[model samples]
Target: MVLLRGFLVLVMFFLLGEALRVLADLPVSGGVLGMVMVTFTLMLRGRVSDELAEASRGLISVLVLLIAPGVVGVFFIVEQFYGQWTTVIVALIAGTLLSVLTTLWLMKKVSESAAGDGRHE
Candidate 1:
């Protein structure tokens, strides 16, 4: 029964992503869309079953290892990156800074809302 529920959750996420892609014209891949859908669902529900939690952890653990082959293939383009290294470095730095700022801003907004609710009570 637990396994069945986990499977159903996965199917629901996949369907949600597909529906979003069709309805909203999102450019992301189905799996990425599915993952975002699942994350949002978990956040909205505020809880996850033990079986599903375990499955998600296992999947996350193996996710990076699964992408290693493609990462290694980047070595083949080492020569191409030599001249473009400066642009790449700048982009990476800028992107990281933007991501950090955005994350902090969101955290601040959520915290302020929570604090306001507490003050009201």
Candidate 2:
């Protein structure tokens, strides 16, 4: 029930963002906007509910599955990169490394902040 509640909250925000995107004819991703709203909402609330935390953890565990579609899409356009495989692979590696490093840094900062608040486990 807790997980369901958390997912519901996330979905509500996503739908609201998608609606706003369509209505505003925005070029940005609705999911990104929705998450920005979530960040603000959580900041205003001053704490994350355990349910949300659990839901996010679960999603992170299954994140690779979520990324599968993008990988498959690239396959469909494989010919487009006929001679640029090295460049593509290098870009992918660089991007992945950068993302991982950024996430690690962010998590470290968040951990420090949470520890200061006695919220770290």
Query: Which candidate tops TM-score?
Result: 2
RMSD of each: 4.6, 7.2
TM-score of 1: 0.59
On the 0 to 100 scale, the lDDT of residue 52 in model 1 is 84
- Candidate 2 per-residue lDDT, tens place, 40-99, comes to 999999999999889888988999999999899987887887989989899999999999
TM-score of each: 0.59, 0.65
Residue 91 C-alpha lDDT in model 2: 94
**Candidate that scores best on lDDT:** 2
List candidate 2 stretches off by more than 4 Å: 83-121
